[model samples]
Structures are given as C-alpha cells and as structure tokens.
Target: MAMNLPSQRGRGRKAPMADINVTPLVDVMLVLLIIFMVTAPLLTAGVPVNLPDSLAKPLDQDQKPVQLSIDDQGRLFLENEEVAETDLPQRLERITAIQAGGTPPQVFLRADRQLDYGRVMAVMGELNRAGLNRVALVTVEGTPK
Candidate 1:
C-alpha cells in the first residue's frame, strides 16, 4: 500500500536563472553618462555674463560656493538676484554665516568680459573687505582645437 502523487513534467530541468544580467545595466549607465557629458556645458549658471576664457583650473565641487555676478552695466547679483553695492558687506556676512558656519565663504565671481577692469577690481576689493577671501573667478573654458 503506497501513496501516489502526480509527477511534475520537467522537474529536473535547471532552475530558473538566479544570476542577474548586467549587460542592460551597463548599457543604461553608459547612455546616462553620454547624456550628462553632452548636456553639462549647457547647464552653466543662467546669469548672462560673457565670461572671459582662461586656462585656469576649475574649483573643487565638494565645497559649496555663493555666486556674485556682475553684468555688463555693472549691476551686481547674488545668486542671480539683483543686489545693491552698498548692501554687499552685510549680505556677505549674512550669507557666510548661513553657508560656511564661520569659515571664510567661497564666492564665485562672474563678471562680463566687456566690464571695466577697474570696476571688476573695485568689486573684488569689496569682496575682500567683506572677508570673503576664497574667491574663484568664474570663466568660460575655451574649447581645444
């Protein structure tokens, strides 16, 4: 006397693959990388200053930076919002306090190429006066031949 059960078909076939196929994953990552590479130059800050081109090395991305933009007409902007020249120091202090927690604030200064050299210097002087010592001059990197 024995109990009988229906034998399943293909019972001994190899189990469904447990290994993940990484080919598609790699394909997706490569596509995303190419997209970022193509679009990165288009993503520069929106303030429309014609930055001077230079060979200077770029800043490290790990440090947060505050933007200070000077337009062709000598208008000042803090992160794209118009700012008064008279209010710069207090604004720098406030911004530094909020951003860097007492370390000297890193300011990326962008000035139009047509802007007067003296005006740029005066503005730099203002930033230095406000104790923002870590100033990075933002420039348009020239494309190579």
Candidate 2:
C-alpha cells in the first residue's frame, strides 16, 4: 500500500515579488542632497572682497546676474575671470549679443569696501557703454543703528 505524498517541487515555489524596492532610490536621493548642500556655499563664494555695508534689501532676479568684481587694488574680474579694461566692452557685447532685442542681463557689481569711488565709477561707465544698464551695486547687509 503506497501512501499519497505531496510533491516537494510545488512546496518550494513562491509567488513573484510585486513590491517596489526603494532603498537604493532613497540612498541616491540622499547623496544628491548632500552634494548640493556642500557645493551651494562654494558657488556664491566668488572673488572674495570686503563689501560695503548697506541697509538695502536684496533684489528679486528673474535670471542669474553677471558677477563683476573690483578688488581693493582696482583689478577687474568678470564672473571670477580676470578681464582687461579694454576687453570689458567687447566681452559685455558678446554676452548681450547672444540674446537679440531681449533685455540686457543684470550685472552685480561687487567692489571692495576700500575701492575708490572714481575707480568704481569708471567700471560703471564701461558697463554703461557696453549697453549693460541694469546694474546693481552689491553690498553686505548692515546692522541697523
């Protein structure tokens, strides 16, 4: 007399997994967040200069402003790259020429606190000649008296 026994193959088979795996995705997202957090401060730390203190509010910008820095020695830097006084106008033209008839890009002029007013004005004059009229003098936030 043979006793009926269930096949072992059917018992070993399991249903396919239907749930999504999110551990890897969460790990990737966390890595990206950390990378951005680390590099965000570095992006804004361009051309270090002692900026003058002002009690003015920051401007609301629709686009990234061009960074024009004047060091204490009156050296000029365009977007953190050194540019000759004579070459500034041409560079500015090239930047604006990319967008035909569109409003000129805003320029954030960062001058050292010790920079002479005349030197700053001269750079501003150059900016004006290059048709870059939307210029904002960048300054540090000052404590109220």
Candidate with best lDDT: 2
Question: What is the C-alpha lDDT profile of model 2 across 3-99, one tens digit per residue?
Answer: 6555577785655668999999999999999999999989995798889889999999999889999888888899999899888889988988875
Q: Candidate 1's residue-wise lDDT over 4-96, tens digit each?
A: 444467565554568999999999999999999999988768679988888777767766788999999999999888989998888887875
Residue 31, candidate 2: how far off, in angstroms? 3.4
10 residues in a row with least lDDT, candidate 1: 3-12
Error of 2 at 126 (Å): 1.0
Candidate 1, position 76, lDDT: 96
* Candidate 1 TM-score, true structure as reference: 0.66
lDDT, model 1, position 53: 88
Candidate 2 residue spans exceeding 4 A from truth: 1-9, 15-21
Best by TM-score: 2
